[model samples]
Target: MVGVAMGGFCLAPFAGPVLWRLLIEKMSWNWTMWVLLMFARVTVVLIATLAETYKPILLKRRAKKRGLPLPPKLPTGEALKLVVMMTLQRPFAMLLTEPIVRALSVYMALVFAVLFGFFEAIPYVFTSVYGFHPGDTGLTFLGIGVGLLIGAAIFMFLDRTNMSLLCVFQCHRRLNPDCCQQKSERWLSLPIGLFWLAW
Candidate 1:
């Protein structure tokens, strides 16, 4: 979630200036499409590297690779079906039943809406309140842009904090360095899932 949102937030702010520059320079939408196409291609590369990190799935693959005998199957496959059903149902169940989720959802939704609204409202605010001219209104957004960059730096601090906490347990109980590296990567796999889903 953090990776996807961070990546999305990072990309979205620059998109306007890029498109505007293309329009002013080339006077055609072709350059805009080309830039978007390049972004699409980079996302395509992420698909191959992003992979399953589920413990059960990883264990199953390891067992298959080693030619290990598998456990007996459920007679009617009902257990597997039930697990899948619950997995699909749990998020909606939480959203409906959990007050914390509802509150956070409302808070974040409102915050994001206001953030986008502020783009348009900046011109109006400066024009009405501060008496900024039509041309100078563009300057008001510089502070917001700089804020986004600083927020991104702060975001990296949070990401590193979370990663360290997650990997610390696995890093300690290790005789081999490779096992520790694997564990740390396993924690990182959680965040990398967002990129593929974002694509």
Candidate 2:
């Protein structure tokens, strides 16, 4: 349930223009929002049927089988400190130290900026180039939406592949240090993609 809600939260901003485009193209912006609200009502109905997963209950049952004592709850202050330490400090450390995470964070930040800039420019571009009204201008955002979906699908396909092959000599032993040093050169692909995407 939480995952679904988070997913919806992440997607909500991008959905705004798409929902506006889907409604009557000539209607006022208020009516378009009303249509969106109706769609949300349908979404609520769809989500009401799902079952919840109770992880704590299952974990306690397994602990009893192993003759382990029940887990103790942390004090409120300790729990808050642990959450802050894990969520902020650990992720910040990883951002600085992990090459893949650093590169991907930069890439995603740039992509989001570009997308927002394109969205901001859409009104000027459509009005100046084609003299399109607001509703028609909203429709152009569909192209951005389609491109985002395509890019996401491509990344999903690449992520599922065993990319370790690119770094390893075989499935058993790791690549030699000499080979790994030379292969580090190929990590230049990240910058190359940025250049290509920029063009």
Candidate 3:
């Protein structure tokens, strides 16, 4: 419930610029919405057919199906409070304890801002600087897809290497935790990918 709420609301903030970019630089607004609806329909079908893996939830659901009483849903207000508390707590805890995490979060936020700004601003540049048609301008999005694939490849390579490096680094430092190294290495690729998209 919380994931769906936050996912929709958090993503809603960016939807206008996204739709605008599509209309101004890609296909018409009608086609963009049509495609989105199609995607949503496909996603709903996939999720409905997927098997539940959580043991407790699966058991409860099966028991209800077999005529047992179902658990009550949490009250709406209490559910909202729980979502807020849980969502905000762990990140705050991590930020307080981890200097490396704090620094990386700051850097990633800046990179994300630039990337989103570019997504909003590119139509003007592409239409004016390059004099490309909307269809051609939309093709630039392909570059972003390629950059993402490259970043994923880099992350996979780093994941393989991080395990070996942990052993050597552990031998040198008695209590240091390099466990976060893999996460940081994977994240560092975001700024690089953003740079590629901008260029």
Best by TM-score: 2
lDDT of 2 by residue, 122-172 (tens): 667777777887667777778767754554454334334543454345632
Kindly indicate the candidate among 1 and 3 with the higher lDDT: 3
Candidate 3, residues 1-199: lDDT per residue as tens digits? 3223333444444454555455656556687677678868998998999888999799898988899987788999999988887899778988989987787688658756976877757766788877987677766655554554454454444434553466455643311221234457665765786675567
Clashes of each: 0, 0, 0
Clashing pairs in 3: none
Instruction: State each model's CA lDDT, in order.
Output: 0.61, 0.63, 0.62
Sort all candidates by lDDT, best to worst.
2, 3, 1
Pairs of residues at least 3 apart in sequence or in different chains that clash in candidate 2: none
Ranking by TM-score: 2, 3, 1
TM-score of each: 0.51, 0.57, 0.52
